[model samples]
Every structure is written in structure tokens, then in C-alpha cells.
Target chain A: MSDMHIDDFKHEALDHIHHHLKTYVSVFVALMALTVVTVLASYLKLSLTATIILALIIASIKGTLVACYFMHLISEKKTIYLVLILSVLFIAGLPLLTLLAKYDVPVN
Target chain B: MDIPYTVQPRPDTGLYNAKVGIWLFLASEVMLFGALFSTYILLRVGAIDWPEGVDVLNVPLGTLNTLVLITSSITMVMAWAGCVMKDFKRFRFFMGLTILLACVFLVVKSFEYGSKFSHHIYPKEGAFYAIYFTMTGLHAFHVICGIVVNAYLWGPGAKLWKKNPAQFTNRVEVAGLFWHFVDLVWIFLFPVLYLL
Candidate 1:
């Protein structure tokens, strides 16, 4: 940070400001691969919990690629990350709260 | 007054106000969908005779829609890149592809929903179908919203490019961010709703 001039930093940042079409194609292919994995995993005769976990893991990978590349989160600033982290924190809590529903009566 | 930070970054945040605004909006959207997904998990975990989703949903159709969304995501980014490269014609072409893909997605989704309704598989059929209708119906609403946003940017919004090119490009990028978020949600929803 100290060595490079402020102008240099600006130039370096510009390099990533425009992503190439090739990267988008690669990401698209990766997403398709993960989608195939998810569908194939669902076809496996594993226990329900195992299948769910596997599918979610694959989905998470696909989601990560979309968010990082297409959403441009990888090149985003700290402020945006702060907002996203907060959102993730709050959203993560919803699932925990959902577990509370287990104590309630079942509909079926 | 004309919008501030439409073409320049704010000193403090080091980002244009619109960029910050979109991220905040997306963050909130994450929670909105997250809450529904949590409810799905809670419901599925608690239900006794939870029907198998694969048996009920058409996996082939879901897979095809996944491809549609993935292709749209690529086209969407290409559109935004076209803006960055100062090629309005390329931007319009890629954007048109994006809109077309979105319409195809909606058409396929409509067919899926139609079959369910025709078979009398209403939300009242059972818990699985209820959640299916609610979650997919909500997602479909989002698709409509995306279509409207992209369509506007392609039509009247393109006029902005003439007077304020930088700001117009920024707007396209912001719209692409939202489109990608929509695709991100589908990436997860496809496997959960259709396969698992």
C-alpha cells in the first residue's frame, strides 16, 4: 500500500472493473456442472438426510460462483461486505428459529 | 436535482450511492427469501408423511429451467460488460437475449404451474404442494419483476445513454446485479424444490 501511488491503485482496480466474456462462459459451465451434480446426487439411494446435505452443498457452490462472479461481489468494497455480512447474520438466525417450530404440534 | 454519485464514487464509502443502495436492497431480499426457505425447512422437518418432492415435481423441466437461468446470467453479465466497453449495440443485443431467456423461463414455469393446477394439485392438496405453490409462486413473481426491470432498461432507459453514458452504464450494471441475484436464488431453488 505504501509503495504504490494512489494513481497506481486506481489503475490496478480498473483492471478488474470489466470482466471478460470468457470468464462468464467458464462460470456458466461450472454452474451447469454443479447443477448436474445436484440432480445426480438426488437420484442416489442414500438416506434422506444425506441426500439433502449433498444437494445443499452443491447448491451452495453454485450460489457462491454466481454471487462472486456475476454479482461482482469479489471486487466489491468493504461497505458492501458489511451489509451482506449483516444480512447473512440475520438470515442465518431464521433457520435456528425455525428449529423452535419442532417443539410445536405437527399438522400431520 | 440530478443524481449525485451517479457517475462518481462517494469519498467515504468509495462507491457510488446507487451501488451501495443496490447491495442493501439485495441484502434485504436475501432475508426475504431466507425466511421462506427456513419455513420450508421447518415444515419439511416437522411434517409426518412428507411426500417426496422428486416424485411430484418434474425434474427434467426443472433442469431445463436451470440451464435457462444459467444462460441468462451469462448473457446478463455480457450485457453489462457491453456497457462498460462502450458498445451500446452489443449491450442492446445481449440485453435482448437476457429478456428473451427470462420470458422463456416464465413460459416454462407457467407450464409447470398449469399442470399442477390442472391436476387439481392446489395449495390445499398437502403441505408439500402448499409450500411448492407458495415458494414457486413467490419466485415467479420475482421473475416478473426482473423482466419488467430489464425491459425498462432496454426500452426507455436506453435513452439515458445518449446524454449520460457513464450513468447509463452504471444503471445497466446495477440491473445485472439484480438479475444475477435472481439467478443465484434459482440455483438453490432448483435442487431443493425439484430434485430433493
Candidate 2:
């Protein structure tokens, strides 16, 4: 058997840490750009449907930026990602599901 | 020679402890405010003629408060940087400025709320006012809580500042996270309550 040790694990962890720090600056710039886009989109007089859709799309981009960078979800363990995914599902699903009930009701 | 007491370093999680804890707390807060926002949207959609007279909300003042809160966020971050650099004087200075800014935010918010109260624009009457008061009231409560926490962390009686500097930074960072959340909520509230 070879005398391999846990030092390799430590070295790999350090490499990943270095990569994360390097990427963080780019992530911050992207988030800032997304914020600018959202603000600009707000100024357009799109119809209600188009406006809401565009706003939601921009919001999603911003949310992803915050989750991945500020929250460090990208570097986090898989279990944490699972928990976050579950949270998004619940937060997003409940509102849509409730709105669906409104569709089934007859309008006067 | 006098014997020096060696301070124990906090366990390193590779990230700052206070920053991590504050972010976790903010996650829950997002859910709390998220529920309020959903309620507002539902009520607004169901309203027959949405609340009129909302134009009474002072846009200029609200805009001022937004600038104040955003500036405070910058100060808070600077304070955190001071901690990383171990610059106690700058840390205290920025932290004090953040608290003052928070108080300014509260005062402006109070004026806006007071205007509503004087006009009998309450949440009890109809859907618009209901969502309006509920959302704004809850946010105001958060602002008050933030102010109190800021005072505790930066006030003269703060033990964390004297005993353990790292712990103090952690506390300030946590408070800053909450402060930023308060600002984030207002970003959404401004357009919904004042502009739209």
C-alpha cells in the first residue's frame, strides 16, 4: 500500500478556496449589471403581462446572483443546496398553486 | 511583569462567524417578509378600485429615507472592513454613523406613517389600506428593532466591544445583515407603496 495521506485532501480544499475567491469579483460585477437591467426594465411602459414577465425574469437573475455569491451557495455542500432547493420550491409553488385555484372559479 | 491573558480564537469555519450567522438569520427573514409581500399582491389583485389617495404618501421624504438607508449599508460594510483590518477607531466611528443613519431612517418613516394616521388612512377600512398598513407597519417594527440592536452593539454599555473585539465585529456584522435586509424590503416597498 502507498503512504498516501490526508494532506492531499487539504491541498485540494485550498485549491478550491483559491478558485472561489477569484470568481467572486466577476460574480459581483454580474449582479451589479443585473440590477441595472432591472431598473431600466422598470422604465419601459410594457403591457401588464410583458412587464410582470420581464420583472420576474430580472428578479430571478438577481436572486440567483445573491444565492450563488453573497450566500456562498455555489461553494456550499450538497446538503445545503438540497435545503435551498426545497425552500425555493415551497416559496415559489405556494403562490402559483393558490392562484390556480382562482382560475377554476367562475367569474361573474 | 504583569501576566497577560491570552484570548481564545473563535473556531474558524473559513468564513467569518458573524457573517455566516447573520446570513442564516436573513434567510428566515426573507421568508417572513416574503409572506407579507404575497399577501399584499393578493389583496391588490382582488381590490375593485384599489386605494385612492395613496398619493398622499410623501415621495420626496421616502426617497430621502431610501438614500439614508442605502448609505447606512455602505457604512455598515465599512465598519466590517475595519474589523478585518483591526482598526478599532474606524470601526467605532463607522458603527456610530450607521446607528445615527438608522435613527434618521426611523424618523423619516415615522413622519410618513404619522401623515397617514392623521388622515385616518388605516388598514382596517379596506383592502388597500389593510395591505398598506400591515406591510409598512411590520417593516417599521423591524426598523425599530434594528435601531435598538445597533444601540446595544455600539452603545457605551456594550460588553462585546470591551471584552472580545472579534465577538463585537460579529455582532455588528449580524446587525448589518439585518439592516441590509431592511433596506432591501424598502426597495420593493418604495415602488409598490409610493410610485405604483
Candidate 3:
């Protein structure tokens, strides 16, 4: 409430921004590097499974960087985490269910 | 009535109201795109002869757009950070840059789409093009939406900063969240549609 305390809070806020800015730049460089890696890997002519897995792994890492750094999910609230967790559960379930239905045939 | 928790974290949730709202919205978005992704997987698995994306789609353009979007994501984050630092000019610069990058992405995408159309490759061409058009089109729509929101924040919505800096910062943060989610979608889409 005092003016001294207000100045202290301002310094703290500025420090946080400085730290976040560094992270933003670092994540950006990493993302660009990974983009190049993904593109190059595609031309390697790996088998279908290897190709899919490798591409996905790179994409997931890139996605995580965006989510954690750019989206600020790394410091987000527990409520937000819960919402995402539930959504991810269903997102994961959707494909598994689809695959199951596709392969599940009535035995003659 | 003034909205509570616009600038301050709520007691129970420990986040500003918009922060909670945006994440919930993003969660649903994840499901929406996830369903389409599942459909893609289903169709690809069932098809006897799936077309190679690299053979059909323009990888160079896709790669270019990928870099554009990634750059926008960083700028978007920097814009929010600018607000956090109480630097209005910095915020406007980065926010405008983000919008411009989004525009570049759309321009590139339009060229890509135009080439496909000229080649008579519509969504009806086959399952591959169908999913390709559907996913990238949806992602592009999201990009447009982000541009509109960011333009407002940079142009008019930013007035809120003078009135309530904390709330304005929160708005940018929320917008950045959505923008990054769009970028995240493209990170996956680029490889899945253009490369793999």
C-alpha cells in the first residue's frame, strides 16, 4: 500500500517480463530449428511408420514449446490445467475409439 | 456491473476470469480439431492407396507459412510482455508485427490454394485433398480471427490500457493464448498435410 512497496512491486513485475522475454526468444529459436529438422527429416524417405512417428515427435515438441512459453501454460492456474487434462483425455480417446470400431468385426 | 477478476486472480480459481474462459474455449477447440484429425486417420488407414502429400502439396510454401506463423507467435508473446513491462509503444509495435505476419501467412495460403484450384485439385478430388482443405482452411480461419482481435487490441481495444493497464495486459495475454493455439495447430498440420 505504501509508495515504497509499490516501487518494489514494479521492479518485480519488470523482472518477470525480462525473464519471460528471454524465454520467448529462446523458444523461438528452438522452434525454428525444429521446423528445419522436420522438413529435412521428411526428405529422408523413411518408412511410413518412422516418418509419421518422427514428424509427430517434432511437432509435439514444437507444440509444447508454443503452449508452455508463448501461451504461458507453464505458469497457468491449476483450473486451466484441469480443463486441458480433461480435454486431452477425450482427444486421445477419440482416435482410439475410432480405431477400435474400425477393426472390430463381428466374428462369423 | 463491472466484471470481477478482470485484472486480479479470483480466489477460488486463482486466475483472471478471461484466462479461465479462454482456456475452456481452447479445450473445446482441441476437441473440434481432434475429431477432424481422427477422421483423417480413419480415412488414411482405410484407403488402399493414399496420395503422398509431398508429391502433391507445395512444401516450400508450407514451410514458408510455418516460419511466418512461428514468428507471429513469438511476436504475439512479446506484445503481451510489452504490456507487462508498461511499454505502450513496444506493445503496439509487436502487436502490429504479429498482425502483419498473420497477413503474410494468409497471403501465402491463398497462393497455395489458388495453385491447387488452377490444377483442378478441389476438396472433392479425393479424401486426401478433402482433409487437407478442411484442416488448413479451418486453421486459416482461426488465423483471421486472431488478426481481427489483435488489430482491435492494437488499434482501439488498446485504449483500455490507459484506463486499466492490468486489465489490458490480461486481454493481450488471453489473445496471445488463442494465437499460440492456432500456431500449435499449424505446427502439426504442416508436417501431417504437407510433409508426411
TM-score of each: 0.92, 0.70, 0.95
Query: How would you order the candidates by TM-score, starting with the best?
Result: 3, 1, 2
lDDT of 1 by residue, A51-72 (tens): 8889888888899999988887
Worst 10 residues of 1 chain B by lDDT: B161-170
**On residues B51-85, what C-alpha lDDT tens digit does candidate 3 reach at each position?**
88899989999999999999999999889888878
**What are the per-residue Cα lDDT tens digits for candidate 2 across A3-80?**
232222224434454454446446545645655555556557677567566756655665565455534466664444
Q: CA lDDT of B169 in candidate 2?
A: 58
List the lowest-lDDT window of 10 residues for candidate 3 chain B. Answer: B161-170
Docking class for candidate 1: acceptable
Error of 2 at B145 (Å): 1.1
Q: Candidate 1 on B1-196: residue-level lDDT in tens?
A: 9878876789999998889999999999999999989878888877888878799898988999999989999999888877766678999999999999999999999999899889988999988888888888888888889889999999998998776666777888888888898998888888788877
Candidate 1 to native Cα RMSD, angstroms: 5.0
Choose the strongest candidate by DockQ: 3
